[model samples]
Target chain A: MIIQDEDQLTAAVLAETERAGDPRVREIVRALVRHLHDFAREVRLTEKEFDASLDIVTRLGRLTTPSHNEVRLMAGSLGLSTLVSLMNNGTEDSPTSANLLGPFWRQGSPRMDNGESIVRSPTEGPPLFFTGRIVDTEGNAVAGAEVDVWHASPAGLYENQDPEQAEWNLRGKFFSDAEGVFAFRSIKPSGYPIPTDGPVGDLLAALKRHPFRPAHLHALIYKPGYKTIASQLYSHDDPILETDAQFGVVQRLIGTYERHENEPAPDPDVTEPWYSLEFTFVVEPGEAWLPTPPVSAQRSH
Target chain B: MIIQDEDQLTAAVLAETERAGDPRVREIVRALVRHLHDFAREVRLTEKEFDASLDIVTRLGRLTTPSHNEVRLMAGSLGLSTLVSLMNNGTEDSPTSANLLGPFWRQGSPRMDNGESIVRSPTEGPPLFFTGRIVDTEGNAVAGAEVDVWHASPAGLYENQDPEQAEWNLRGKFFSDAEGVFAFRSIKPSGYPIPTDGPVGDLLAALKRHPFRPAHLHALIYKPGYKTIASQLYSHDDPILETDAQFGVVQRLIGTYERHENEPAPDPDVTEPWYSLEFTFVVEPGEAWLPTPPVSAQRSH
Candidate 1:
């Protein structure tokens, strides 16, 4: 298999994959080599560009830490995460509520009673009383499901990514009641710029693209009989909802943030402009499990 | 720009590239996104598999250093390096004598006179006397060109990778004579395994592929009026030449390692057997420049 040109190079690389023991590995690797070679051929990629890409990839790995997963961030920024999520989840007719479980998920979220506040530490923002009703494709209630919820604070930093925030300040795990309803009180989450200190940031600046993700609250629901659904409910009014940096937005995932002014606040201490968000989560029947947390440690000062 | 499915995901991502201030960046990045999303869809890449890939990508960066370039190695292993080299080097007919400047290449090789051994320290193996003639497409001699030569010792480690070896062992820069000829003396290099303590190792193992590259000598020739050609001259008899791990071997680059017996050796320390290699390097007229070094620091004991 002496390679004489680009085609021969591609063929030779594909030929070697025939020796793989696993059929799935063979299939995936063959496709990868084909697409990878095709990319080089399509762009007629130069050695100089190839070299620079290697540096960027190297930087991706070097910059990743327990608090920041640069590799995953780059994938989301490229839209592969959303593509994979859409392709793998849901039926052909009914899309699954499944979405990307971004790098911010942390495990061991403290269990809280429905309607209790997940705000473990003092924080300032308009209050949000969010309610979710878990249902099946038939619109039947799926009760007793464990729903894990978390979101960024008003300052646009996850508890794990900001040291000033107390542990699990905006994170909680709530179990649905007999009516398949779960609710929690927290601050209204808003769009924020992704961390720009890494390679992905360089890419955003290079593309003249903003790094803002539309405001969203993340939830991971688990039950034994049904598939686990990891989803994000985007704020419909966020300016960048149409241009989410992570490409996590989907039409069905957008939740309305109904504003109420001069209305009775859920807590008497709360002032005006509090909000309410209600959405239904649909889960399919399949294997159910938890995802390994992507980010774990809090940022150090 | 709402991404409802995989195709929409791809379209949205590509559309964003339109905003890139640099046209070249837009083109390359758009093609990359299309191909990347296509790969995920073609494989229906699972969330678990996608997550695993991020870990692998992260390791590629974390393992890379001034001395070890795992990201580049992964690219070469996948044959992207060779495909790009073949594409940008020469026209369709007369293939350019260009090859991949593998991560092993370093800058500032010491200058040496014609026929001087690059073996700056004691090493084991059969001695080799190599000569290279520089020529244009018309077979005319190209004079006053500089030829940089380097190769691994029989132990399969470059000087920069082995602290036991003296400074710049098996590396030298030589000026071509007025006759367009440059010759050097060194050990007959042999095939060796690529470094396998990282992601590439996992890939090779997963594919049941061998990691050895055929024995070859590397040369980077530079002249003001000609394109700099980075090349690898393969031993015709090397078993793995047909299955190079880096996909670096080309038909024209294989050189016959003529053997001698009971003849006077080039050195006064006579030996019964020595090898000689003679090949002509053809460089087309174009810009000439040196590449940045990929590896530098020596391995610490």
Candidate 2:
């Protein structure tokens, strides 16, 4: 058979389900065939163009890595990442909104005591004390919650991407104290452009869109019996927050960084001028915590 | 924006093209947006599912190598390889039909004189004599054309995958003599299954399809000022020829192998009876000849 028309060919491929031994396999194949056929029809796809698209996808697979998540980058730039975050965290009354975990997030950050500074580079940006509480929907504090926090330095480079920085500079793991209070000092993160050098960059350039992501701090909060929240706290004043390249901006996740000077505080070892931000994350009760495979896990594999 | 509808969101993405500096970039992005949007809509895709798909693609990139064309394998199984071949070599009238250069075919095979056998392993299978001529469109001999051929062993494994086989067993590069005639002895290839232990296999399994390709020998014929023909000669009797998993079989490329036994003029070196196949290929004029990249090239950076 020449397999001329794509629709007919797709239907033929799908029709094999009638003779399939596994029902689940048949169902998945049928759905895949339908979607593939529908896509071709909707786009009025030509054989040549369809083939070119496939070639590009094949190139994407060939270009992926632990440091370079080209496929995830493609998915993020295409709005698929945002769509996923919305669908998976659609609880109406959830304390916090979730977002893309991004392709960074290295493992084994220094675990520090509450109130300890995670910032190893004091000169990179303004010192900031981040204080937050993990609580339930009813406003009850949830102590002993683990908070995984990480962010790019003021120069817009993650420790993993910068040879000058230590292994986990400005990255740390902390637990909420007995009163559900968590405090960590770190340098303020600055807005940075997503890497635009690979195929993903080519895609963004082709789309004529900017690749800048607003300054934000990444947080993954975990408390027993409460849905873990994987989210970003965006600086309210950052311009890209309004037009995030990945469409990940949520109104509730925006906050302000307040500047404080000459405050006589607990430790004189602290820098004279510093900034601070106080926020609380409310958790919802659910079993839908889909933990991302740690960066180490993928590397180990 | 929440981006509830995939089509509308895709339209928004494509609209960014108005700001593109290059017209070609704008045009390509437009087409990509349409196809990608159509794919999502056709699948009634949820955000979470799309994210999962991105994860799969990201992993694919990290698993590539020069020797392993995992991305190409994925594309071939998805019917994209055929599409790409069609795009690059439009349906112009050519003496020989083109097929996908599957994920094998390494560089640097031993060059053989005309009529010399290519099979290094005598115990591999029943020996078969293969003869072919390289001719131009008018049927005149195109002497000095190089023909590269390789196939799986009788037990059905390529040299790259089977460690037991010598480096280039059943593989050779030959030059056509002054008469455009070339011949080699090798075992008849048997129908075999594609590798089914990876994601491609997962896709095939989900589609409720077997990953069998019909018995065939891969050939790359090249001469100056002519289009290189990357093709497969399929056995006419193979059961899966009609439904090759990669959709690569063509009627014109199928050949018949005839059994010859008890000939009085048998050569002293030959002990067992064998089969024989004689076929000729016609070439078309083109620019500098370049053989199609092996499927491995698709995965190699």
Clashing pairs counted in every model: 0, 3
Error of 2 at A65 (Å): 5.4
Name the DockQ score for candidate 1: 0.79
Cα lDDT tens digits, model 1, B1-301, are 6777655678888877778999998999999998998888888899888888888999999999887788988998898888888898877687778997876776788889999999989989899999899998777888999899989888888887787788888899999888899999999998899889999998898888889999989999999989999999999999998788778898889999999899888886946599988999988898999986554533354
Query: What DockQ values do the models have?
Result: 0.79, 0.20
lDDT of 2 at B120: 74
**What is the C-alpha lDDT profile of model 2 across B1-301, one tens digit per residue?**
3233322455555555677787755665666556555555545565556766766665555455555555667766655455444434424344345677776776767899766777775536666789888887777898998889989887777876676777788889999989888888788888788777667777777656788889889888888887777778888778887677776665567878887677521345766777788787766677545544555522121
Error of 2 at A68 (Å): 5.2
Question: Distance (Å) between predicted and true CA of B228, model 2?
Answer: 1.6
Superposition TM-score, candidate 1 onto the true structure: 0.95
Q: What TM-score does chain A of each model score against the native chain A?
A: 0.94, 0.84
Docking class of 1: medium
TM-score, one value per model: 0.95, 0.71
* lDDT, candidate 2, at A186: 86
Computed on alpha carbons, the lDDT of every model, listed in order, comes to 0.87, 0.69
